[model samples]
Target: MVEQSTRATDRPLPLPRANLLHLLEQMVLIRRFEEKTMEMLALNRIRGYCHWNIGEEASVVGAVTALTENDRLITSYRDHGFAIARGTPPETVMAELFGKEGGCAGGRGGSMHMVDIARGYFGGYGIVAGHLPLAAGLALAADYLGEDRAVLCAFGDGATNIGAFHESLNLSKLWHLPVVWLITNNQYGMGTSVHRASAEAELYKRACAYEMYSEQVDGMDVLSVYEATERLLRRAREDREPSLLETLTYRYPGHSYADAGKSYRTKEEIERWHQRDPIRLFQRYLEEHGILNQGEYDLVERRVSQKIEEAVKFAEESPFPSPDTLFKYLYAEEGTK
Candidate 1:
C-alpha cells in the first residue's frame, strides 16, 4: 500500500511573505527561461540535447527553497530549472546552454550537464541512474567528514528501474547516509508513461524493499513539495535517515527538444495536466490568499522577462571557449604545493 503525503490545503503557508514572493519569482524565471530556451533552439542559438522544465516549476522551486545553502543538490538531465532555483545566475545558465565561455560549466557541459560546486549543486547527469551512486558517494563524504549537510538526488521515474537506484537506496539506509531520493515522476519517461513502463507505478513504494521512509506528493503543488522535502531534509540532517519522495508531475513538452510532444499522449490528457499547471496553480493559491495581487504578478513577469533578455544577450555576445582549453578539465591533477 502507498502512503499519501500532506495536501497543500491541510496547512497554512509556512513561509514569510517575501519568501513566498521569491518562490513565485523563481517559478516565473524558470518558466520564461525555458520558453526562451525553446526559442533559442529554434534559432540555432542553443545546440545539443536540450530538455525544458515547462510544467514542473513547482517541483524545482519548492524543493530547492526547502534546502539551505550548505545542502547539496543533484539531478537528472532536465536541469535548467533546478540550476536556476539553486541560485545559479540565469545568465550563466543560459550561457552554458549556449555553450559559451560564461556558462556555469564554462561551456563544456551543455544542456544536460550543469555544475556549480561552490553553490553545492553537483550537476545534472546525462545517463539514466548514473548519478545515484555519485549522490551516495557525496553523502558518504559528508558522513565521513561529520558535516551537517544533506544531499537531495532528483531523478525521473525511468531511473527507478535501474539497479543503481536500489543499490544507492540500500546503502544509504544501511549506513544511514543523509540523502533524499526524489523521483520527479513526470508520468512519462521520454516516450513511455510510468503505467506503461513499471509494474509498480507508485514509485515511493519501492522504498519499502529497502525499509526506508517514503512518501508521494502532488508535484504540481508547490506547498506540498516544499513541506514534504523540508520534512525529509530535516530527517536526513537530524536523524541521518534516508528517504524516497515521489513527486507526481508531468512534462508539458516532449521528453526532449527533438520530439513533438503530442504523438505519444492524448490531447485531453495534456489539457488535463495543463489545467493544473504548477505555476498557475501556485499563482491562484497566492491570489486566493491575497498574497499575490495583479500588480505583483505583473512585476514578477516584467523582471523575469528582463532577466531572460539579458541572459540571451549575454549568451549571444559571449565567445565560444578557445580550442586551447579543450583538454583542460577532463581530470584533476595534483598540485605541486
Candidate 2:
C-alpha cells in the first residue's frame, strides 16, 4: 500500500485561460485521433498489435505538458496519445499506423513504436518493463554530458512487479539520475485487475524500497496530474532526484483490439469510471470556469475532426516502404552490405 505521505491531494494551481485551452485542445485531439484509429483498425487499415490510449488522455497530456522541449520521454505500447501530446504530427502517426513510408519510424514501427526523437519523444517499447533501464541509461548519459534535461519514463501498472522496474529504480536513486517514472495505473494491467496481480496495489509505495521521492495523483483529473508531474519533473531537473509517480487512471477500451474488455470487468464498473472521463471532466471544468462556451467546444471538436480526417488522408496517400529497403537500418556496421 502507498503511504499517506506519498499521496498527493493538494489543489492544483490555477491554470491560465490560454493554458487551459491548450490542454483541452490536446486532449480533444487525442480523443478524436484514438477514435479514428479504432475506425481504421476496424476497417483493417492497421494490423498487428494495436493498443489504443482512449480513456487515459488526461494522464498522457498532463504529464507530457509539464516537460520542457529538451526533456526526453519514453513510454509503453499504449502510446498514440503520448506521441501526439509530445508533438509528433498526427499525419505522421497515422501514416505509421497505416504502415506507410512517411511514418515517424519510416513505417516500420507502426502503432506500438511511434518515435520522434527531435521532439524528445522516444519510441514506445512493446515489452513490459523493458524501457525502464533504457530510461535510466538516458538519464545517466544526460548527467554525464552535463545536460540539464531529464528523462520521463512512462509504463503501466503491470510493469511495477517486474524485476527491471526495481533494478532501474535502485540504480536511479543510487546514482541520482535525473528521471521520473510515471506509472499509469489504469487499474487493470491488460486483463488482470490490480487486486489480482499486485500484493500492494497502491504502486507509489514501491519506490520506498529505493528511498526515492514518490507520490500518487488523481489521474482522472488532468490538473492534478499536471501539477504533480510539474513538481516531480522540476525536482529531477534541478536536484537530479529520481521519483516515482503513479497516476490512477482507467482504460475504456479493451487491453488490445483482440479483447472485448467486458470479459473481466462489469458494465457498471466501466460506467462508474466513465463518469470521470478525463476529457469530459476537463471540458466541464472549462465550462464552469467560463473558459469554454458551447461555441468554443464545438469549434474544438470541428477542428479535431478535420485534423483526424486530414491525417487519415495523408496516411492513405503515403506509399508503402519498398520491400528492397527491408534490410536498411537493421545493422550498425556500414560495411555489412
Candidate 3:
C-alpha cells in the first residue's frame, strides 16, 4: 500500500444523489442491525461465535452494490452486513444468527455460514483460509460451466498470510478464472497491524506476482470503493480476467464483541477512524447535494431502527431447528438409500 496522501490534506470523497442515499441507507441498516446483534449477544439470546462487520460498512455497501446480481460472493465469518447488503433478507440473517428454523441454512448455519446460494452468496466461511480455495473452485466451476458470471471472494488481511490464499490465487490465474479477490485489509490482522506480522505489508503486490491486475482503495470512501469495484467487476465480466482489490479500511468495534479493546488498539486510534465514518460521510454528501434533508436522512435512520427491531422480533418469535433437521442438509440423502 503506497501512500497517496502525504503532508497535504486530501479532498473528501463525494457521492452522487441516488447512489449516495442508497449507500447511506445500507450503512445505517448495517449499523442498526449489528448494534442489535451486539445487544442480543450481551443478553445471551444469540449463541455461538459472532463477529460483526461494523466500521467496515463502506466496503460491504460499496462492493456488494457494484456487483451484478448473478456475480457470486464468498466472505469470511464477520458477514452479517455482507449478507444483508447482498440482498439476503435481514429477517433471514437475523434468524440465522439466532439459530431459528427459518434462517438461511434452515437454522443450522449460524454466524459463520449464512449462505444464500440463490443470491449467489457462496458462504460466510468460518475457517480463515478455507474459503479462498472454495471461491477459486467456484470461479473455475463458472468457467467450466461456461457462464459469464464471476466470483467475488472477500477475505481479510489475515488470510493473505495463509498458504491457501497463495495457492488459490495461483490456480485462479493459471486457469484464467473469472473472479475478483476483494481483500478487506482493515489494518489489523486479528490484533496485530499488517506491518507487525507481514514483512512486506503491501499485500496487493502479491497479486502482481501472479500478474493479476490490482489496486488499493480507501475503504472508508464508499464512492471510491464503488468506482473501483465497478471497474474491476466490469473487466472481470467482460474479459474473464481475474483481479485483486485491497480495501484499506478499519473496524470500529473490537475484533469481536468479547474483545475489550485490548492492548493492540488505543482509544485515540478508534476515535480517529470514527471521525471519517462511512455513514456520516455519505449522509453529509446526501445533505450537500440537496437530495435529502435532515428530516429525510432521519427517516432513513429511523427506518433502519424499525427494520432491525422487526428483524429481531421475527427472530425472537421464530422456533429453533429440530434435532431431526440436524442431519438433513448435511450430506447427500435418500435417492440411493
Q: Stretches of candidate 1 above 4 Å error?
A: 1-7, 333-337
How far out, in Å, is residue 69 in model 2? Answer: 0.7
Question: Which of the numbered candidates is closest to the native, going by highest lDDT?
Answer: 1
Estimate the TM-score of every prediction: 0.97, 0.95, 0.94
Which residue runs does candidate 3 get wrong by more than 4 Å?
A: 1-16, 335-337
lDDT scores in order? 0.91, 0.91, 0.84
- Best-fitting candidate, scored by TM-score: 1
Candidate 3 per-residue lDDT, tens place, 120-141, comes to 9988988887899998899888
Q: Residue 324's C-alpha lDDT in candidate 2?
A: 98
Ranking by TM-score: 1, 2, 3
Q: How accurate is candidate 1 locally (lDDT)?
A: 0.91
Ranking of models by lDDT? 1, 2, 3
Per-residue lDDT over 1-337 for candidate 2, one digit per residue giving the tens place of the 0 to 100 score:
2123222224333677899899989999998998898899999999887788878888999999999989999999999999999989999999999999999999999989999999998889999999999999999999999999999999999999889999999999999999999999998988999989999988999999999999988787788889889889999999999999998889999999899899999999999889979888888888777778999999999999999999999999999999999998887776664
Give the CA lDDT, 0 to 100, for residue 164 in model 2.
95
- Output the better candidate (2/3) by TM-score: 2
